[model samples]
Target: MRFFEYQDRARRRLTLLLGLFALVVVLMVALLNILLLYTLVEPWQELRRLMPTAEMLAEHRGFLLWTTGLAIAVIAGASLGRLYQLRRSGGGRGIAREMGGDPVDAEPEDPKNRRLRNIVEEMAIASGLPVPAIFVLERELGINAFAAGFTPHDAAIAVTRGAIESLNRQELKAVVAHEFGHIRAGDMRLNTQLVGILFGIEMIALLGLGMLPGRRARSDPGEMRGPVWFNFALVAAGGIGLIGGRLIRAAIAREQEYRADAHAVQFTRNGDGMAGALRKVAARYAGLNASPAMVGHMLFANGAIDQLLDTHPPLEKRLERLGQPLDEEGLERLGREATDRVRRAVTERERRRREQEAAAEQRREEEENGPLGEAFGAVPGSLAAALLAALPGELARSARNPHWVADLVLYLILHPDPEIREQQLHMILETRGPESEERVRQLRAMVPEPAAEHRLPLTEMAFPALARLSRDEQRTLAGLVERLIHADGRLSATEYALGRMLIEHLDRRHGHGGKTTHGRKDPAGKNARHRENAARYLLATLALHGHPDDLEAAEAALIAGLGRFTGSLPFSAPIPEELRQASQSAAWARILDRALERLARMPRHDRQRLLQAMDDTVQQRGDPTAEQRELVRMMAASLHLNVPLPDAGELFDAGH
Candidate 1:
């Protein structure tokens, strides 16, 4: 099913689950009221002797109403308080820290952490999502991990030390993929809500225990001890409610785990990797030393072994689902084989480490010999490699540091004209203080002028750190970016692209941003016209920007792009005169801005077509310019497309 479908279904399931929790609360309140009537309300102590009359009922009605109201208020109040706490803590990153996780550095010194970071980055790039902030539970020695967040934009992935140290590369990849599955299926949001609900239910038991009778002076011979019995009854009701809550949470969590496992297989296309990881988890099961009642439902495996309340399915059962059912004897053999593989892998890794060190030293020596010698080094092959080649080392390192990232962003968007740049620097000083302004100046001196291609990659690298900022800080940074972009009084395509990408990404991470709702039924009538006009505006912008000197070429490129959506759009294609008038209007920027807002809501298939059309427009005049490439990347980011940035060769060949 599509992501939006899963999201809608999850919402329905959440409502049902919450209703079950409410039923548990109602039962507890009923029990409390019964205790109050039987123990406290002394109405002649004889309901059997009393007449069945309206006046008799009216006499006890007030007392019964008071007891029920108090019980509900206590329970509902506790639940709302827990929900408030979760909200204040800032979603996934906050949950990770609360569970004793430390943020993994972008350039980690530990080899294992580095490996985990690389794997996450690779998966994120392929999945077309922002790279989630990674954290390590340094104290946890259990093979477990979890994804937490309200939405994909703010998601965080955390793994224990044992998970990284025990699992090999493929096994670790499978585990991470399983968590990503949760993010994609909208399980993280549901898991977070479950945490709050379970906590509220458990509060009844805690309150009862707090109120239990303690050592007291000897009571007089006829003193009432009914309150003592009342306390015990409260404890009993609370215990039953807690158990019911756990059962409900576990049932829902078990089904989610199975779905996540299926997603892992789909993502990796290898069942053995996930199956192997599960077997190892079974063989080496160490409990997580955290609040099991609150976090268990979100973990990769059940943290404890309560059969009736375990959040994960049995390991054997999970293996069976993965097409690797094994008896005890087979499990033992697999465990032994896994141990042997780890030993061999360690040795191989050490050898590769040494080789890499030698290669790095050789490159340093070559780089020292000048550009000619540097050219002898390995050629840029992949997107990552090309980015590294284009970005200066200092700028790249700065992008990874949260302290310097905001400054880096400011420096990248400074106006090219000296007078305008000085105005921007002055604006930064007034708004962000002298320290920030100085940092931006220092960055400018260090890089002098970065190439056009390096801008987006640098911004992309800064995302994890950007996510670390508080909401207010992100908003301030966003404001600063906007002002700098418009400082020259005219927005370049590059400037609009860069500013839009930054603001949109930060907005989503703050949990208030609008998410793409793909696979929804297409809009009809007026809405359809609006969408068509938005598409036209975008295509016109790209064509005019790419071929600024030649109007004939611009019109041809525009037509070529529009042809991709010929049958799909609601309205007819615009003629050359219309295109010319639209491109020449002074309100072109405002039009493009509105167009982007509309296009961002396009369905998944429509988005893919739009991207293809963009590529066609860029390659209409042989090779695309640097400015053209940057604009395309920015446009894709603005639309929240999951695909990687297309290269020049891909752009040229995409038209066919």
Candidate 2:
């Protein structure tokens, strides 16, 4: 999906929007200054009647400059103040609250809401992103949904009550996929930023509104007439600023909406659901009266935007682009047909969803049997469903039950070695008590053998649960997981991946910084020698982990991977024995983390070179080993690269 490119475009658009906003603010200031000069001149003429022609108030020029500057300051200050207020509300949650949405539970009480939760989960799993919190705008009867957050980890998806009551299962799935597209392509952050920044520009209208009460007083016999004109000027200036802001907001939002629709079709591999949903929205343009002006551009449809400032493309254009071109008559006819079909299908849709979920429950093995290639970005819905199905019943329930999921994560880290297991078990028993012990014990028996591929998929499932943890509980859960891993006295690659995943997902929700490397510099070749050295350090670290017991094999793996990059840096020297010794220390964990971040931050081409070299290193023996596959996966996770798990069948010989 080229996250970097999408992010760059969003930033450029924001920059241009801000520039236009600034120009408007300047014009407003000029308008304000002119009004002040006119008002001041009226009083000056009154004084001129007292004194024949008091030298034309030359200092009025200075007053003109002063009032103009004051006007600029007032407008800028009000705008910035509004932005700060919105920013403090936090990203998606703030937007949801502003739109009158109610936060939903992972296991919602209502049956329909349960289906909504399921669809959201499927999309999150398919994309290898964390499950975003869900909300439903209960009062709104519009067929709309929007995603909001600075990143996927902190994102929330909100759907209108009308959509819930109207959309069938597949239609709802398409809507959720459309929102996920925004979350994935970094649109939500831009959407959130636009909401916050534009609020400042729109505050001019509020300022004008505040000046109205005094206007009536000015009409009294003793009151001055200047105040009335000033109030009128305030309203006019604010109206102009508001219009400019809405225009910019509408222009930026329309293109993003079109792209999001396309992304939905791409993600779902079909347009039927999206087409149906759009038809419904076209038929029902009604929106909530409470939808705030600041959020108009963030909605699935133009919630309450002026006709001239509509944030979404026309319904006809959007549907046509989705391969369901419809005219006025066709759109209305289709909407009626869809509404009837959705009503009839509701019961059947529920039945099908239940049956599919039941099959997943019965066929858990297929969940773990998907090709490793699906692990990267844009996971197929079938694979996503299989993985969901593969989850054991108890763990699956725990994933949906926010209350019991922390123990599931703790269960995965229980060591295999008897001694280490005993240590971890003791810690669990001591800190978490008998109930926690029982949960872990049952999972230990029920969890699959070797627990390699299953650990991450299971962990991914646990994200919703982890997200629901209280602050203290999250802290304690993190500490407990770390204690179990270190209890083994050595960090394995799988353990490292689990820890990173936990931190990356949970920390962001807990208010800890979880920024991605979208804007980081590609410092790869700027320091060619240093870059090569870092690459060697990374390869060496992975090699050692891949062949822990045999130092000779470890070195061989390193040499094999380095061979792929031979021509790129002929002048770089090999890792020294001292450096190799240092790489084996516990500190190597930190080194590898930094190395992965550096590689991830590099330009797309450089990142490809790095991954290619690592792949050659892993497949050097012409048969992919389990350790080799795992090392590659962990590297991808650390780099935040969503490369699909390598194709096991193609990469490995039979019975290697």
Candidate 3:
């Protein structure tokens, strides 16, 4: 099924869970009634027969009322206990965070924490969803994890630190991707519902225990007569209810884990990553698949191992389903191997990142200035004419999409000389008419055309202005134009200089002193104010690049760059039709924040490359929107500089 289809299925499953709960409740009531008739009330009947009088009959009725009340109290109390468990467990990190814990610093510095953060960002890009918040489980040695959230928008993925250190890149990717798949597929919603239902089922067992005490609190009544009628009645109900709830949990938990594993395999496109992970678990602790305490059936691997009466099928069986023969390797070997592969993956990733960074810096140094009068000369006249020819058809279709054109206009305002944008603005104002002749006449000078209108105007207006952001944010902001050419990884010298020049113009417009720290005259580390302003300028410049000049988006980006470290949150413009479109959301923002946190101390070139990569991804989807552009800009700004700065609004129209 498509992702949305799975989402729908999950929703339906939620209803199904409710149905099951209702069914169980009915069964419990019926069972209680039958037991009460046969046991507690039966003794009353016998006593009444012995007394042979009206007063005895009345006493018998009173005894029956008390027995029913006791049953109700037991059931209700159990229900309450289960609720209490859920309440206490809210926003929980399960066992991982509790054991491994967080470091003392405001920003995370732990290696394991860093790895987990990186994996989540990588997986998010791979799967094309907003990065969800990532969490770590430190103490768990054997492999296990779980994705928890109320919805995809608010979801979090938590993994064991052992799992982080153990799994290879692909395996780790496969694991994180698997959890993302659960989120994208809406499985988390259903899983949460299942938890609630299971709680309800357990409530019955609680009721049984609660009533057991009622049967015993009969000191006066016991002396008058054997209180077996009340005592045994309470015990029976409690025992039955508790047993039923446990059975339901076992039934629900096992299947979902298997399904989640399949999803992991599907996402990574490598059966080995997930299948290998399971093998590692078995070998690590002699088939110890114990779920964490109080987290039964909740972990990625079985927190508690219960093979015989457990919900999960055997690991070998799960592997065989993936077409892998598990018997070939011993379990411990697989575990260690999987763990080692993940570490190597992390190292290689860091290496490639460094190279990309170095490459970007080299380009920036070569062409250290923005294009002058002749830069537009680089454009071929034919391509410009062709753009003119296609403008009308392209314009009419997307003009109504609300978010479509606005981002591009914002981008233009950011890039190019202020005068260039003002003239483009004049064109926009002049060509507001609908007539083809009027449009053609206006377009005559702009392009060598039978004439362009919205399309040509929009493109010419958008790209150059957006190039004002740091190269990465510029690349991302250009996401506004559907077919706009974009270069990824390292920026060309021309692109680098173009970005620097635009920032210069912005400084003038915003009333900041021009190039306060620049050139050979001002060596590095000479000016603290310059350093502070420079960092803040870069953060604002990067974040506001493609944003629609909005306060909230700009503020968010600034905070991300210099704010406290937190889980990955989605930060892209909310696509109206969430289930259908693949777009950024608060979930992905968390991943982007982690990326920024890691690179916070890095130089601009590396920061630019990663941010651009995000933009490249959005455009690769065929046509990037304004919302996407804004998000990328914000991310680029926030990277590696979680330092506080003025609000995004104080900087530009984006802040406004």
Candidate 4:
């Protein structure tokens, strides 16, 4: 449906809700009238009877009492029907069942619906987003998908089984990416709120119905004559409330679909693929709709959005809104066009990225000898390779819990103090730790005997033991350790320290030096010198963030940062020239800011690093110092820009 059509429908629904609220007020009034008759007229009738004026009193009260009671009873019957609709339109269980997912995570899994899970993972990697929960609809043949969740971390995407089997990888990616667009753009929050408000609109009518019985029960016997008039107004009010709410929810949610569709196109750079996917579903309309009642407001296209009844724009119109051709012959063209268009787009994007990387390399070389250079940019190439290699494997696997790998990151970072190393060794010696003799034997059995550790330190042995697991298993295990370290809020200091250490150790054990020359520039090139300078500047900025008060601590931070990055890409693996530089600058800048902000917030500590950065700054430039220059370097990296060298006067002054 066209996005605006959904917006219009939601407005209409809200209007309906307002109308229904008025009806509920009227019904409530009718119920109140019945009670008033009992409390006022019926008692007065009895009073008149004792005074021998019964006939006069009875005639006055009878019509009004019966009228009020009748109005409430009629409204009750009509309101019950809306409740059934309330259940259906809510899309609560129908959606859950279709997705083969339980609203509650503890529900047993259905073995038949695993495809939904796999598609979500692939799309997430392609789009550079974390994976979302996937659900399957066993009974649905409709090619429909929706993204839902309160937050990105908890978001869910559900598609029918037909969607998976019917669409190829690209189309599936298009659809999933569309859903993520909704997730990213904050449409899901708006969507969830619509559901909540619809429920609130119903609450008033339900309360009105609940009050009806009590009104009837307490009426005085034979006191007031029934006047059916009051009850008539009551019933009219309730009907308006029910229909009004359905329109409101449908209206608000429908409009975002177009935005989501366009976002999917942007995300995949394949308009025709997304358009074609929609076109294919529209062509198969006969078998592609859920029950109108089940998908009423939740679907991409309404099941019942016939020209006359639907709140959404008609299907042909929606396709046109996306500039897609309606016929089958055109769909094939769109498919090929989309593929080529995306390939070209990807190539261009990669090219722009490479150029940026090359420039960053030059900047790094220029900044390397600057006061802050060494602390700034430098990641080992091997770690970058591992990250790239990990991506394909991570995407292809089923039963992914990347969080498990994330958790193990802390373990991988394990470079414990000597005491901690000894403790690790003793734990291994106890024959209880997993790194003990038996595990070593198992490792020897699995790998070449030459590669097995017979006399290595326990710290060294622990990592290879982990790497021997099947790739997926290793990810899972690493993810577990990471989880433990970061269990609450941020990872504990000890955890962070250890995780980095272990990461370095593992890289070493695998004969993988984190350093690589993939994106390094030629030595004689001017750009090469600039790139070297940028790395040095990046390190200095990071070293400052570590609150290094002396050369020793500053040097340590430089080592850690260099060790962490060095010859590798800051984030991704297989460093392109443009990305490596941009990454080096971007990462160095971010970590610098983050680290500095962390230290800045802490109470003044007399730690060696703290004293080091302080005294070192004072010594470099006397008195007020070039702290401002350092600040500029720190901030420049944060903005992903190289700080042009200022003259000596700009950096330091002896005026004081």
Considering every candidate listed, which one attains the maximal lDDT?
A: 1
* Global lDDT scores for all candidate models: 0.69, 0.64, 0.43, 0.41
Q: List the residue pairs that clash in candidate 1.
A: none
Error of 4 at 32 (Å): 13
- Candidate that scores best on TM-score: 2
The residue-by-residue lDDT of candidate 4 on 304-329, one tens digit each, is 54443353455565568667757856
Could you arrange the candidates by lDDT from highest to lowest? 1, 2, 3, 4
* Deviation in Å, model 1, residue 408 alpha carbon: 5.1
TM-score for candidate 2: 0.72
What lDDT tens digits, residue by residue, belong to model 2 across residues 392-467?
6666656655656787788777777777787888899998898788777766776634336456656666775676
What TM-score goes with each of the models?
Answer: 0.64, 0.72, 0.46, 0.43
lDDT of 1 by residue, 1-656 (tens): 23223334545665687688678878877676665565566543554543435554467788768977876676677767876777677677888898899998755645788778766654553344566889988777667898887666777899988788788877887898788777766676666666676666566667767775555513442343565556666777677877887787777787777777776664454678798788787766546788434456668885566777787888877888777875676666755655565456557655876877866566545432222111111124345434545567667656666777788889999988899999999999998899889888888887788888778767776788787778899999999899888786677667777888888788777554553322234354128677766877788778878876777787788777877754443333443343355423434566676677677777645766888888777777788886787788678766656444443344421111
TM-score of 3: 0.46
Tens-digit lDDT string for candidate 3 (551-589): 465546544543312223335322122111112222322
Ordered list by TM-score, greatest first: 2, 1, 3, 4
- Report the number of clashing residue pairs per model: 0, 3, 48, 108
